[model samples]
Target: MWQKLYEELQDQNFMIIAVAMDSRGIEAVRGPITKAKTTYTSLIDCDHVVSDLYNMVNVPQAVWINEEGRIVRPTEVSGAALSLNLKKMRKTREIYCNAIRDWVTNGEDSPHVYSDSEARAHLPSYTPDIALAHANFHLGQYLWNAGNRTEGESFMRKATDLNPNSWNFFRQMKNLGNRLGSGGPEYMARVRKRSKLGNEYYPLPDMAGMENLKK
Candidate 1:
């Protein structure tokens, strides 16, 4: 899916820097990337430096950077849906992909392109709790990488507790090992908890034609 998008837009100065934010490293993402045969600057972001810089909390969120190194679009749930199985998801991605094409072809003139003020308005706020969550996450990541698995995982849990809205923090910890049960009873429990807390595990993007999606 992403490969096709890259191929279509590559000639028009459009580059897709697809990043995999997996703490378990390249092995966690190698199969998918290999299967897709992606050629457009794919990378493994173990520490999630890109997410840290962009204030992303979920998978598939993306930012649009122009030739001048200016962000024309703030980070939002990207059109690169992992599964286009549902009709609604397909439509969302369709709208998103067309918007990208329109923006790339028309540049500044595209209606899909946001103005500086609009982009700024869409930027995510960095609250103190969120800041602390990131600190705990990185410290956990450092310790986990340095072979202190037990203590590292504790801090990672602290990160998630601090910012439960950040699926990145929770999901990475879940992916660290099979014992945590990334897709088991505990995972489902947390998913339900997210809903009760008014934060869907996978929230729909705030796009046109998706008004039915709960806020």
Candidate 2:
């Protein structure tokens, strides 16, 4: 979906820089990128520096930055325009794609583009606990790189305990061969819980003035 947009808008001074937050390195993401045939600027964040800077706790999140280095939109769950195997996400994909098109064509005039204060309002507050969580996560990554799996896992667990809302931290640990029980605070377990609560993992964008696009 992004590649299609990149093709369409590249001539219009629009570009997409995809950052993959995979700790296992480029080899882990090479297969998927190859399958997608993405041509835009693609980067690997082994230390999750981008994730930390953007305050992203989930995969497939996006932050729209304008040409002036301003954040037009803060981090939010981003989906492809093309439908995946998940039929339930088709409507969401359509809405998301339309919003992107509107933004691209209208620029700052687009209703989807938030003002600086509005964008900042959506960003998460960096509390001391969250800071500690990030520190622990990076420390864990360092230890894991040093071939000390035991200590790494310990720090990873502490990071998770400190910031349970961060799926990125949990995902990194899980990818590193940490197996949690089905009832544990793993990805699937959280999904199931959120489903029961009628909560959407990717909340729909506010489409107040753009109601006609729904048709």
Candidate 3:
């Protein structure tokens, strides 16, 4: 995806930089990443400081920061238009190259375009409960990945209790159960209950591999 966008913008004199939020360091990504011939700049923000600054709670979130250090669009997205390409890329695709090309060639005319208001409206609703849940979840994941399994599970359970509708949170719980069996049926039950609340937005674990969890 980065490579495609880099190519597109290279000819257009536009600069693009990808700040990776992956906890893994740049050395891990450099080998496969360097395989692409891209002209744009890219960096990794393992601590998520930049993501927090931009209020990007998820990956694939984009911000069109203008030259004046002002954010023109904070949530201009691209994945919506790449479904078919992504499907094809599943076999033989150079994602970054194609995407970069499209963006650079089309500039703002690309498939993903949004105004400031539109971007702001796309943000998560600012409910106190939800905000607190988000905080807990973030801390939980940080702790979980940092090897503080007990503390992570504690915080994650709190997060799930606050926002039972978050499939992602429950997914983490499910993973924890697999690892430590700390929170088993009870936590899994919360996942199912809340997953139902998410309806179409929620994706339950595949029954084939994870059916036992639901049982």
Clashing pairs in 2: none
Worst 10 residues of 3 by lDDT: 202-211
Residue-level lDDT tens digits of model 2 in 1-118:
5888788777877789999887778998898999899989999998888878888777788988888988998888775322234554665666777788888888999988998888
TM-score to true structure, per model:
0.90, 0.84, 0.54
Off by over 4 Å in 2: 80-85, 178-185, 193-200, 207-215
After TM-score superposition, what is the CA distance of residue 53 in candidate 2 from its true location, in Å?
A: 0.5
RMSD in Å for model 2: 3.9
lDDT of 3 by residue, 1-215 (tens): 66654554566667777776544356746866687655578787644556445544334556665445655455423332223345432422333235445544675675433466765665545456666776786787688778997898788789767765454455545554474332577655654564476532322211122222221
Q: Alpha-carbon error at 140 in model 2, in Å? A: 0.5
lDDT of 2: 0.77
- Name every residue pair that clashes in candidate 1: none
lDDT of each: 0.82, 0.77, 0.53
Residue 67 lDDT in candidate 1: 95
TM-score of model 2 vs. true structure: 0.84
**Predictions ranked by TM-score, top down?**
1, 2, 3
Instruction: Tell how far residue 151 is off in model 3, in angstroms.
Output: 0.8
Per-residue lDDT of model 1, residues 64-153, tens digit only: 899999998888888534343576678777888888888899999987678989988889887888888898999998899899999999
Clashes of each: 0, 0, 15
